[model samples]
Target: MAFVAELSRSVQGRVVLITGAASGIGRATAHVFAREGARVAVTDRAQEDADRVAGEIRAEGGEAVGWALDVADGQAIETVAAAVAERFGGLDILVNNAGTTRVLKIDDGRYDAAWDFLLPILLGSHQRMIRAALPHLRRSEAPRIVNIASTEALGASSPGSIYSAAKAGVTGLTRSLAVELGREGITVNCICPGPIHTGMTAAIPDDNKTIYARRRTALGRYGDPAEVAHAILNFCLPASSYVTGVTLRVDGGLMVRNA
Candidate 1:
């Protein structure tokens, strides 16, 4: 009840857009933001999952809507941005959370495939969405952009993950945009999440998790999607008004050990 009251004071009546809201961190973020009274736009490639997230938020007495989106398509992003503006009267927050990658070494024949797919989804899409959503974001008094990167972006030397390289671009974009948008009173930051216990990492064996915990993480465990969501909510809150253009890592000390 205390947090509920605080939600009303901190996040009530804001319009929020989150990509990749079908599952994992994006889904957790949708719940967190919606609970705090934001009018959440739950968009993902999976129509069923996106609909369910929005439905659940509405069922819980929060304002929400769902749309199937391919973040790699800039035109589609523009269309969705327009729809959100019309439906919500404006936008206050943007969470660019959709991402993917293929594991391929440069020597592999499929390296081009990995590069093409990952770059568009991870970096190109985030940039396009920002361009499409800028006008609506500019209208808000407290506009916030939370670009999701990865701990790999912080120079993790993750040779196994093509996603890591793309995320580095996202981190760069976050820093640059923070400066460009600062004059507009819009705050831009990034979340470089570590190895979270999400669907994408489900294939990692228990042994590997144990090894990673012991060797890499000071916290000695994997992170949860909700944990990353909490960091994201921190950026969107009015209390974080002074924090901008920073990459906050939610990596459970993976970077600390590696660094």
Candidate 2:
């Protein structure tokens, strides 16, 4: 817990809104942020899971609240943003970590599968959240947005073409928003993670995982959720105000190796 607490640079009293807070990277990030003394708003499509995360935070003596949100819906994002502002006074951080992926090759006669599965969550949801939170973020003294991406955005080409494209769009959005919001005291950045052990990755066949481990990753294992959370915490620090528009890769050197 102390180690986790040290990850954040004293964000005590800051308000953070995290999307996809039900489980996986989002849940892990929420826990890390709460431990570091941030007031967290845990949001997910599943109301029960969101409430559970909020309860765990409260039980640990952290300030937290849960909201059910369909990140793909603009109206829902707007409503949740308003609720967060009213509850926490203002927003300091927005983490666009909600996404979905479907594995389908471009040459397998299923190219559309990628777009159909990833567009709504990756592109649509991120834009909606950013739009909804912009007003409140402008009012805060320090505002940050962290967009989660994948190494595929840089041309990995394993999971699916759609996921790659969507993540690439995320990278683009991070840079664009960083420039658009820099003068307003808002910093935007993206994180590109390699193969991580999460529910989403669990769907991949064991054989494929083994192949990926053997060939791609220099660490010889999938990345832990905490590793990504650590990077997220770094982005939310006030000291990182000048670090916007950059994509930090947390892939354990996988992207550089073609094993």
Candidate 3:
């Protein structure tokens, strides 16, 4: 087989389930995988948005279906995971990309509420989805688990302590799960995106975004959701069979600077 053809065929006919796929990086990931010929399960807390994304993929000539899933709920994760496996015939890749940003001070009234609200979705949900999808993943010839963490996991931002902690936990979970599932051929990995132009960062002014990118990242610009989506795609490719437990930073060189 030709090298390029083999690479292109790697992810073809695979089944991929992505959480929080209604918008941002998750949405981009859904489209990318579907374009690569994967049957996609587009899931989110908002049913309409999820369905809209699925519809868009179908209009683009890809196989996809939408499901309303609240990742924070363990039972919901199990139910959705099973339904996706059944709908798509079987599961192959699971992307835990559902999350939000919350900044809270230790003395704030909502500090405890922030922890309660964020941890379950950002950290716990990854574990829940992995467990729920493990059975189906084990049946596949090339199974993969990609957990979407954030650069916050590697560095600290004031008042984002809780969010950072939760994301950090995600990377830890990825490493541990990778070791446990290595012998089974299920590769687990983590992606930490930085300065992405997503809904979470939409509130930041353009000027500030520019200045931050210039001063921080080596690329000197904010990354698009599709950029991170493609990084996620790399791990899902069958060619990545030997790669596991990797915490990749799709940060446009944000982590490499000291100046």
- Write down the lDDT of every candidate, Cα atoms only: 0.89, 0.88, 0.95
Ten-residue stretch with the least lDDT total in model 1: 1-10
lDDT top scorer? 3
lDDT of 2: 0.88
- Count steric clashes of candidate 3: 0
Compute each candidate's TM-score over C-alphas: 0.93, 0.91, 0.96
Model 2 lDDT per residue over 1-259, tens place:
4553323367888899999988888998999999999999999998898999999999999999999998877788999999999999999999999888777767776667657656988887888898899888888777899999988899757657788888999999999989988888799999998888888898888888878787778887788888999899999997777789999999988877755
Clashing residue pairs, backbone N/CA/C < 3 A, model 3:
none
CA lDDT, candidate 3, residue 18: 98
Per residue, candidate 3 scores C-alpha lDDT tens digits across 124-178 of 9999999999999999999999999999999988989999999999999999999
What's the lDDT for candidate 3? 0.95
TM-score of 3: 0.96
**What number of clashing residue pairs does each candidate have, in the order they appear?**
0, 1, 0
1-259: candidate 1 lDDT, tens digit per residue: 3553323238789999999998899999999999888899999987788899999989999889998899988888999989988999999999999987677666888887778877989999999989989999988878999999998787656355577778988999999999988988899999999889888888999899988777888898999999999999999987777789999999888877853
Pairs that clash in candidate 1: none
